[model samples]
Target chain A: ALAAPALAQANPEVRWRFQSSFPRNLDVLFGTAERIASRVAALTDNRFRISVFPAGEIVPGLQVLDAVQAGTIEAGHTASYWYIGKEPGFAFFTCMPFGLNTRQLTAWLRHGGGNQLGDQLFADYSIQAFPAGDTGAQMGGWFRNEIRSQQDVQGLKFRISGLAGQVFQRMGAAPTLIAPADIYPALERGTIDATEFTGPHDDERLGFFRVARFYYAPGWFEPAARLHMMTNKRAYDALPDAYKAAIQVACAEADSEMTSRYDHLNPIALRRLVAAGAQLRFFPREMMQAAWTANEALMADLAGQNPRFRALWDSYRPYRNELFQWFRVSENSYDNFAFPAAAAAAR
Target chain B: ALAAPALAQANPEVRWRFQSSFPRNLDVLFGTAERIASRVAALTDNRFRISVFPAGEIVPGLQVLDAVQAGTIEAGHTASYWYIGKEPGFAFFTCMPFGLNTRQLTAWLRHGGGNQLGDQLFADYSIQAFPAGDTGAQMGGWFRNEIRSQQDVQGLKFRISGLAGQVFQRMGAAPTLIAPADIYPALERGTIDATEFTGPHDDERLGFFRVARFYYAPGWFEPAARLHMMTNKRAYDALPDAYKAAIQVACAEADSEMTSRYDHLNPIALRRLVAAGAQLRFFPREMMQAAWTANEALMADLAGQNPRFRALWDSYRPYRNELFQWFRVSENSYDNFAFPAAAAAAR
Candidate 1:
């Protein structure tokens, strides 16, 4: 421990502030940012320290991109989809309805030309984004009533985000965007009939099951949502290579750590939720099919309307198509057979 | 760059050698060790440097564990299952027939008590183990003939490894463990009728498609094969906290990098294999079912006979069973719906 302070004294100490889009209450999500900071500090022997601020502490949650872009903060931890209003292409970096799952998304981002394309996109906003965390496939929002078919969605108000919200709207549901903090009150007061937020672990913390008994399966809207650490481009460029490497490595660990935490915690939370009277049900096949149809149409329309979206879709669509083929043959086959057998044996 | 040399002068220089249980030609697999070394060097300002030696350079591939444990090499990169003959519990740290996939295995190892359990087991050998890389779900072996049923596997000479070999033998196949370099020659000369290696990228590199043209789907055996970096306990404990942190971070990056690289490259290799006349086929449902049955029986017998195996199995099985339920609801549902649609649209 004495070695750390000595090393810090030998080097000029660097400090940066990180603003997280999530509140501290969602520790698992927000903790990813803290993990990155602490890891960097530890790796650099305390010469580099990053202070993390939760949502509204520095800038409002949704203004993370704005703050980062304007260099008001050195960095921000937030989902890329939150900035879809600035550019629809932003959604691909986070997730899309019926898009790639976590593993697939990571592969695409790191290897399948996504990182470069993402950098090119973010360069427009004077930010450099690094994948920091993932919320493995979210659940379909908690529902106040059983949704048996596409008709059940008619005139229903659902809180969702990104293109999935558009798909829901196209299917006759009134899709609303609400902050994470407001979701519980909205669902309770019937201000929104249902809400989808992250997965079982985060959702349980929000007490969604208490208000809506029917916990749905398969969040088709945002399959695998990725969180990013956005650094001000000028600030990032000025850092020494070692500092840059520290940030990169820390972000990679944070990415894996958050996903693993979710995978471990979500099951425990789901089991507890069930024991406490939450009914787990699959979104009806009819509804799923309808959403898929709407998603395809919406994607086609977006591609037609936005060149940036088209450029990204052209690359991503084929890569995803190829990935799906491989995954279906590999992951899906194994899971489809093994999971059911394991479930049966447990029963 | 001047800062790097100055930093090095301020710290004691450390150099270590890493022995890899993989050939240099198989860069994707072997490169993980090199990646760790370079990343550590970059992070440590060259105060610490690790030289990587490929299989046969320092010790034979299978002798990696022995060399690391005996302190003949400071560190090693190899698959844990390669040492199952030393203790069958070692197989849990790698992969089993129908074991956890990459993400699930990672979750189990990192967050679900696997790291601690692995350390306890490795401590007995005076080695410290860190997961360094993963080959995401491998493909079923390249076959000389289509396996239409369980009968098709009967008496067939199959090149496989780990517990899967035992399972195959129980299923009436003559399972042989052939070195990766010899697999292609064995398949070509009719010495072995089938061979399962890492995945498409490695298989294509080994030119399995040239001889066996019937490339199979879904490697039920060794779904997610993990590569480990093992260090002598004393050597690891003697390192400063900063150096230890550097190794851990480098290993984490390597783990994610290897998996992402495989995911990116496998699809490309599979497409090329198909174009070059490799017929892609799924292992028959009957055969998969038989393998599952054999796997269960083998696990039971091993648990009954070995206490360590039982202890690890007791922790892993329940975790896996629960993981299956959650994945079935989340990942599988999305893939089942999205994949076929994507494939059809592509066609």
Candidate 2:
């Protein structure tokens, strides 16, 4: 009880600017940046702080990685797959077509050597990335019309990002990368007939139901999309041990909190969206099969063209394979039984 | 860099003794306590430290809540369900028969006012609880003989903790609450016919496979078992604001880390166990359905007998039902497709 404030004599005041690739409208995505900054401030007793900027406040939405790498911002929060143009291997750090669920992805990152592979790629860019958040499984997208089969996908104009765009293109859909702020307008104007931008909570915020009535399930392209806090390596390495620990702890909290928020909010949001006339539908087997074929081919091409992609794929695919088998054992068995059972009980 | 080491001058040194309900052998469980302490020390610049004692060091394994409540230990790490004798509602905080999965439970805790409900329960005991860790879905248990139906479970002695014992008792199994340390001895000596400890990682460590070859899937009674850090409220309220923030951050890390540990370790451990001649079997639908019926009756009876149980159940059941409905949409679709695809492709 005799403790007095040491007045932070040993704690150097430090400040960093953080940019989010998401617009401020998406609270779960953009809010995670604020949460991380706030936790760091609290843990460090205000000696260390971070200021957050939404997309376009500094660099445009998709330029977060470039800004962080160039030290224009000390850190950036963005999805890893958005930088597949920089290196296809970057996709593994985020999510891949037919990849891990939320828990499986985090497990891989924390224990299955995922961070090492991701770090190896990030180091080349003068960046160190931490898995800061996840959006669980994204709804496939909102379509103006139902996608029934492979034929329906042909020549479809889709606003999609990451390597999923490449796979859609392979399946004969014309895919374009649109920033989050731009997706609603593109869909409304019919410039893009469909758009996939996170799940029900965010989609509801964007009022996608008003513009696109046909909502699809299972974003196969992004089963569990993870976001990263990309820090400028020089800036990160210079931090004291305690500051480093603060960032690690804060980022991990954001990592857990994001999905928790989505899980809590999405159900309520989905119900509202449905009430507002968003007709829910599942992608047909033929289309999913075609998309799967396309994804496989596109990934193979990426691996053949990019050595780093191959290296990450080598680490990621086998772990995914083995984890899937185990999940199908206990985790899957439980969910397959329990979710339906709960739903039925409520009925 | 004008900072001098002002830590000793400004910070008050504080220390606390912590106890774990788990033994040191279960690293993922007890190791979480150590991780929390380490993270706190690093964040607080070694000014605040907690020394951890394993179960039986201070009090027996199941006496952790009592120790924290009585201030015998400043803090304790244990599961909530172990103290169901005090309140059947505590089982909802840990897990329940046909309860939420790992993500669903955490989601409820974080966003669905689960923490408030739990805190209301703990406040009576002069304790504060924070969810610190999770072991995804547990495998049903290690059984000497396969449980093919309701008939197979009649008079079977099972070493299971929690209200699950009550549920099993309703299903005609004689269930005993045994500490983690005593479970192996009970199983080995034929004192218990079956035991459901955690999933593969802890079960494998305990050598349950050596004595019980018939391992079961889908731990229905505990789809996801969560652990908590229970701190004496008197001790917690006296901490510095920064110290409170440090513990919150560290516990969140452990919350995320525990599932990651299980997800990463379970797959490998499962493979090893199966290769060592362990038989993996799914609980027959007949048995699962019968167990569900038994669980429903037991829960209803508890709700009738205890107002607190009814209060917690009132909050939990609806959130779970709604979450399950939402999960069956995108999450189920993705996992149902991706997991099986990955497994088949591996073959």
Candidate 3:
């Protein structure tokens, strides 16, 4: 109703540094940081600009939580799982073996009780978090020995992470931690029988297929992993509501783009990997059954002793189970019937 | 960069009317329009505002596209398939039977060639489209007489929409078009043997369970139906880049929220419906197989006759196929094993 002159208010310039756990070369991972920075700048007409720095520039890749908490940077972009050692409950925000997939986990965070539960944990560190991106279901691993049955995993030396490592230990595999750069050499030297990384895009870059012949499907351990933008609570709360709103909008786009990009690019990348002699196989049924059994036991055991983990798990598990039922009724049927029929038609 | 005085520019008072095809009663569908309007206004500090109107206040529910195109309204919230009779190519923007689910279709629009193909189709209508929301696969239908086999569908009278209607016709059901308000009465009087609606939340509101005993799974035709924000191209082009960015950001939020809200709300509603005596069932194997066959034939038939529809189908079908294969390898296995095991554990 009023003229522009009457409503005009001064736009304040706000600048902050955002550090990413991922390096610049991994476009889908690190690119989400760049996306948030640019979108925020555009949304606010450059009034609020966030400068993004890759891992190791300011802090080590996995130290993003510490950096954000210590206020070494205004914000940090990293997977929640990287700091699970800091709080075992943090794994719920990324994903777990047999956890909710992309949409399910996202629905949990955004709409279910997961976000509130997660923030309860984040508040302890004086950081505010928002989902910035997701890596869709990844490849399980590249294996030198294909596990045709549950017996094959017994005493197998596997290179994997902690939560999944515990599950593998339940299934009788000795899980060993190896750095990403060391994975290829380890596989070649027979120091690791199998190794898991990100999806085909990053895996192809790592050239794991050259040493490990059998590449498995469904990345059960990480059904779909999410990355977050962790803003120092002090920095985030000081922003004018409009600038804060801009951050919310921009972050939503990143939350969506990161996973959608993988969905788009991974298939094309997987084809290249297959053409280069990567053998795609489903993890044998017996191994998957054993892994599922172990996964449940591990969660129950963690819930029994860690009350904080129990608080998050209480919501995460029930929500996970409910969606599991819903997706099975809808998506599972659609994918099951549609994929084979379409593939058959093409053939 | 210059100081505050130089960069400060007026945010002009801009307003537009947004009409929604869905009624206010379907909160999730109509609520997205309200969300976008508020978000845009907030992002621009009330300088830009979109006034939302429910259907029938300005035009009938399905007239959104025409109103937006003819400039009677600046924008519309409607499913693209609502106007397929105006142009068959419109169906590709919405889901098709056995086509891509929510994430798969969304990825195509955001990253694959889909947005280009869709924009080409929309350009002719003088409308710019953005995905505003999605309904994760609808329930198959409420059946007065259950479809236990392929032959069970023969001569069955089903109140359903066009594309799926054609497939049902191929499967020998006499597809009838009845208004939503008339559907239940028709089924009650045996004028229709079954009726299709949205997922459990909306269906529960319609009280379909009172008349139809069997509610089925996997709405194959609308595996994940997307609703779009269709803006008049002329009105849209006149906006500043900042305003455009605001629309992009707000629509993304709506796109995520609408489906997630359903995912959050549906399971609770479904559990209630079951307690209210709704008999849940899967469409039998034979019926699903026959429906898939009919669906493929119908798509091919449309492709044969309508060159514009053919143009979109070529991109849509292959992309759908690619994602179907990818999802089957990941989500399918996870859901199949997890849903049953979790369900059994709960029991």
Candidate 4:
């Protein structure tokens, strides 16, 4: 092992270009990729390098995953849900509405059967994926008006992406998939009635609060949103073992860092949003009920369509059910009574 | 707010019993007052309640941070650094060898701060504190190790806690820390060379880890660790605002679980010291010298004293004169080359 260092000492420089799904504006997500690129260069003694391109620089922001899939780029950073159009099952790889929280998701992916399952799923796409970042559960979307009942969503247009769009569509609302850059204009032009980005902090930073006054609670659509570093299968396959581990370790590091940034900043951002007159509202029971029904039906349809989805769902849903049962016995009971009153009163 | 029947109706009935610090055997440390009992009960519309007790009854194996902190037990969580006794800087809140991981400690206290931060910190503690618990930085503890060259750490006995311990003590030989119940036997049996208990994790688990692992991390002391809750503090504080936000919200949940339990656990056990096998070693010169003499010294020392710690060091570290300049450039460059070696090879 010691001689390994001496043997590797004489390697030439390798450089690759990478793109990000997020703009530099959303620091952590974008920063994670930047950090990995940074750490890689540092750890390799300057022998390997990655130059990152933020959203929209090399290709359209939303096209990063495709770029990696098409081998247009060697690697890229993105969220799986972004490509749900490619396959609804992809949503499970990124996040699930009202699904597992961060730790549970990580456990499933790392220690549980998730990683192997995920790689198998991505095999057809000719890409390899790693769990790089998580946003925990997110805040619900931002809306221009207070949603008093399910009727409020009857014909609303929302800038939501991935499988969640199907859920909204089921509620009789139209789901519009728009890139982050196009969101502000669309919402401003009344093209969409609502949009869910992240928590108050990112929303405020993007000035969504300026246009939308009603901020919903419990980002049920993304109970735990994960980001991935998708690499072209061929390109990725070409690297030495150490580089792969570096990517894995670096991705884990970034995953940890990104969540930390969100945890630290979200509180302040929520406070700021509230102070700025952003009215926070929990989804109405009727809405939650309706969404749940739609979500269940969508999943059923998905399972019927793909064997992979069926297999993954068989493993995934049961775990979620178990977690829910446990949390219901403890987490929910406590949170339901405590947070609403406490959080509201705190302000 | 009081007239909102919907809110009251939504509250559930919950009671959860949390255990910690003490062995199921050592009742006081583990059983004392079931910290989150009232809060868990309150959160669940009174349908849920938790009665916390010592570790033996539920999980006598090791600390229950993740089980409870992740809401596994509703609450069995405990002190932050009892594990740190294993890792260095891990003792920042729970306890440290030489110093504190304090403020950076708390900043990293939640999901966003650092890897060790957040609910997972308590996940090991066995409960979810969520903003409900915290402990300030802690004192470095008694160690069996003596000071000498870095090599002296080789074969020395230690019973430290957390990740830092692994990084530091692991570099050489003989870094170990066991639970309170096991510590006495190990020490009496000469199984451990050194140990660290929280000023409290040990007190409750009882002095063996501390008694045997006497020597502490130099300069780092705690490196400023921040202790916190090992429960659903969010759940607990979710009660009426009166108790929720009024709580300090600073105790770094895991350490809170650790401290109270250590205090509770440490009292009853009798220890028969093992002879000869244990030789206390202070961190050797090269290690301490490396920390003090390298940029780490300037950074750690400045962080220790500064309120901002380099405007919280996140920003400043990158900006400081040539401090990380090489890694800033060369490190990332090299790592990008070398880091992907494994991923590429696997493909």
Tens-digit per-residue lDDT, A108-173, candidate 3: 998888889988999999988998888887778999988788898998889997489889999999
Report how far off residue A99 is in candidate 3 (Å): 1.2
Model 2, span B168-233: residue lDDT tens: 898888998777777888889999999999899899999999999999998888888999999999
The chain A TM-scores for the candidates, taken one by one, are 0.96, 0.96, 0.95, 0.93
Q: What TM-score results for chain B in every one of the models?
A: 0.96, 0.96, 0.95, 0.52
- Residues forming the 10-long window of minimal summed lDDT in candidate 4 chain A: A1-10
Higher-scoring candidate on DockQ, 1 or 3:
3
DockQ of each: 0.55, 0.66, 0.62, 0.03
Which of the two, 3 or 4, has more DockQ? 3
Q: Could you arrange the candidates by DockQ from highest to lowest?
A: 2, 3, 1, 4
Instruction: Report the C-alpha lDDT of model 1 over B12-115, residue by residue, as the tens digit.
Output: 57778899999988989999999999898778767778999999998999899999999999999999998899999999988978778888999999888888
Tell me which of candidates 2 and 4 scores higher on lDDT: 2
Model 3 per-residue lDDT tens digits across residues B163-270: 888899999989987767778788899998999888888888888899998988878878888889999999999987778989988998888788888888888888
| Each prediction's TM-score versus the true structure | 0.96, 0.97, 0.96, 0.56
Winner on TM-score between 3 and 4 is 3
Q: Which tens-of-lDDT digit does each residue in A93-152 have in candidate 4?
A: 888865666645765676447778889878889999888877766777899988889999
- Per-residue lDDT tens digits for candidate 4, residues B188-293, read 6767755554433333345444345442422243433343345554556454432232122112222233332322222222121113132323344466544333
TM-score of 1: 0.96
Q: Tens digits of per-residue lDDT for model 1 on A49-88?
A: 8999999998999999999999999999998898889999
Give the clashing residue pairs of candidate 2, or none: A6-B10, A10-B6
Cα lDDT tens digits for candidate 2, A1-347: 33234444447889999999988878889999999999998887787889999998999878899999999999999987888777878888889888878888998888888998888889999999899999999999999998878899999999987889989999888999876777888888999999998899999999889999999998998899999999999999999878999999999999989999999999999999999999999999888878877887887888898887888787888988988899889878988888887667777
Per TM-score, the best of the predicted structures is: 2
